[model samples]
Target: MSIQLNHTIVAARDKETSAKFLSGVLGVPVGPRFGPFVPVEMSNGVTLDFIDTGGEPITAQHYAFLVSENEFDAIFGRIREAGMAYYADPHHAQPQQINHRDGGRGVYFDDPNGHNLEILTRPYGSGPP
Candidate 1:
């Protein structure tokens, strides 16, 4: 049998808040709680299980999602409507702008937990870089 990513633990100050935030942004439902974790499953069947940090220092992590053009538009619109700051680059060099990389649109933004979240219409390295 082939191995695949099933789930990952995401450290958050509040599991419910983080799970809800991600679910809302991705337009997906937050999964039922399992023990101390509040899960949000992606379309690929991988789950991001949010758990409280319990006073532990949380380090930022980057997560990138490849979405369709329509999904990107809907998600980006939610980002804008929420008044969240977004950058065209991962380093945040370009403010309030989206990048046209790999011949598709992409944007980087920070989640409430300070995790770097990226959404793009095309997969990186799929075309001319």
Candidate 2:
């Protein structure tokens, strides 16, 4: 069988909260708990499994999602509706804006657990410069 990513573990202070937060922002439903994970299946069939960190200091990680143009608009609307801070760049130097990278709209924001989250309409290097 071809190698594929089925799932990934995401550390969070509370798995349920993190999973719900992600699913809500992406406009997807949270899947049933499997073992210790609260799964959020992506459109690509890969799942982000959220697990609780038990209050330890959590190291943040960056997670990126490639979305359709319409999905980008809806997700961005939810982001702003929540009064969240977003940036055009991952480094966050450009705030309150989105980037036209790869000739498509993109933005960066942080989850409740401080993990860097990104949504882009085009894959890097997949479109005109």
Best by lDDT: 2
Q: TM-score for each prediction?
A: 0.96, 0.96
The residue ranges of model 1 lying beyond 4 angstroms of the native Cα positions read: none
Q: Residue 38, candidate 1: how far off, in angstroms?
A: 0.5
For residues 12-127, write the lDDT of model 1, one tens digit per residue: 99999999998998898999999999999999999999999998999999989889999999999999999999999999999999999889999999988899999999998788
Put down candidate 2 lDDT per residue, 1-129, tens digits, no spaces: 999999999999999999999999999989999999999999889999999999898999999999999999999999999999999999999999999988999999999999999999999888775
lDDT of each: 0.93, 0.96
Structure candidate 1, residue pairs in collision: none
Off by over 4 Å in 2: none
* Global local distance difference test of model 2: 0.96
Q: For model 1, what is the error of residue 116's alpha carbon versus the real structure, in angstroms, after optimal superposition?
A: 0.3
Check candidate 2 and list the clashing pairs: none
Per-residue error at 22 for model 2, in Å?
0.5
